[model samples]
Target: MAKEGDGADSIVAATITDDAPTKAISSQGMESINATATAMTKAKNAIVVVEEACTSSKKPEEPKNPKTQVLIVPLRWMSLGMTRAKQQLVLLLAMRLRTVKTQMMTSKLQEVKAEADEKLKSISGENVLLQINCKALKNENAKLFKGYDDLEAKYTSMKALVKEKIKAAKSQAEAFKIELEATKGTNAESISKVAELLKSPPGFFKKQVKEYTTMVSTHILLVAKYLYPRIELEAIGEGYADGTSEEQALKLINDINGVATSIFNESLDL
Candidate 1:
């Protein structure tokens, strides 16, 4: 019985020794769980810091509304329309100014044309007057030329009659001289008859010469008074038509008068 009791005590002592090791393993497992929890907390704090830094560095987005966007489009269109209206007003004023300038130019052109027409009318009137005067002068010249031709014909007839009278008187004087020589110392009556005959012929010749001289002088004076002035007036008209100076035309007329005066004086002397 003493040996059986000693074995039972040894068995119980071994069992207590196994139970102490199990309690020590359990305490080590609890310490490992606490360290893993602390590491997880540190990782979570680092992720939160990264998220805040990224949000601060990025640009913020502006808020947008549908009503504000639609209102901006209409305001921009109104501004564009006002600008176009101002440009159109400036263009209209420029066009009006151009129209006024064109009207003024047209009026000035019409005035100039009116003045030119008046000048042309005046020139036509002057030309008509000149034509009328020229025709009258031509008629007067024709009448004077006819008168001069008639006077020339009469003067030729008078010269022929004076020549016949001179021939008859010379023949009678010769015949009386021959008769007186033939009847000499014959009779006083015969001699007295011859002497009377000679005196008669000489007296008739003297009377004829005086009458012819007086007629020639009167004719010449008539031509000078009536024909010469008309001829000088015609010459002045011609000079004016030929564009001669007034002084030169006057000098030519004076020269013609001087020649006519000299011809008249010579005829009187004859």
Candidate 2:
């Protein structure tokens, strides 16, 4: 009996001493905490009633009638009281365990949410940086395209200018070639006439000296304009009056030969 009383007292003391809630009211809600606290209070009261009964049973009683000498505690009543107190204690412990588990779950959920939010923020910052880089690259690409177009336009214009210069040079060369052919024809004709005059007999040349000088003067004016400027045209009339027409005619033929030879050589070089 003493041992059972001591066990009951220890259980009640433990129940009373360990009455702190495992979960906070913020996590479990005020209503849930209040209900849990009320249940713990009722369980504690039941344990206190059981402890009081056990303590009273250990006290010394007065010696009266022989039947009343033995302490008459209803076995069923004590058993029911102890059983209900134990059941309440078990229910309270289960409630506290459940509350502690819920609080732990809530705290872990908040931690996971915080980590997820941080990752999302980091990803968003990276995306913004990528967008900025992409925009700069696009602008750079556009500038390169514009510069390429400008260079291409300049290249086309320069090509056309070069073609125009080549065409004008070809046209000028053709005109010069036509003029050189005309001059070659005139020079050949004048050389053929001088050769015919040289073939004549010396007596016939002396007879035709005045006429030959006149022909030579006309040939100089027509074919060799550069040589014409060096000769004195008035000398032909004065030489005929001075009786030196043959000498003047022979000198004119030599000068015409020299001019024709130089013109033919220059044409061959061209």
Best by lDDT: 2
In order, the Cα lDDT scores of the candidates are 0.50, 0.56
My TM-score estimates for the predictions, one after another, are 0.33, 0.39
Candidate 2 whole-model C-alpha lDDT, 0 to 1: 0.56
Q: Once superposed on the true structure, which residue ranges of model 1 sit more than 4 Å away at CA?
A: 1-98, 177-270
Deviation from native of the Cα of residue 72 in model 2, angstroms: 38
The best candidate by TM-score is: 2
Cα error, candidate 2, residue 207 (Å)? 23
lDDT digits (tens) for residues 21-67 of candidate 2: 23312443455535644554444333333334344645333433343
Q: Write the per-residue lDDT of candidate 1 for residues 34-141, one digit (tens) a residue.
A: 343333233433223323322343322322433222112221222333333222222222233345446657988889989988998998898899899899889998
Query: What's model 1's lDDT at 120?
Result: 85
Query: lDDT score, residue 256, model 2?
Result: 68
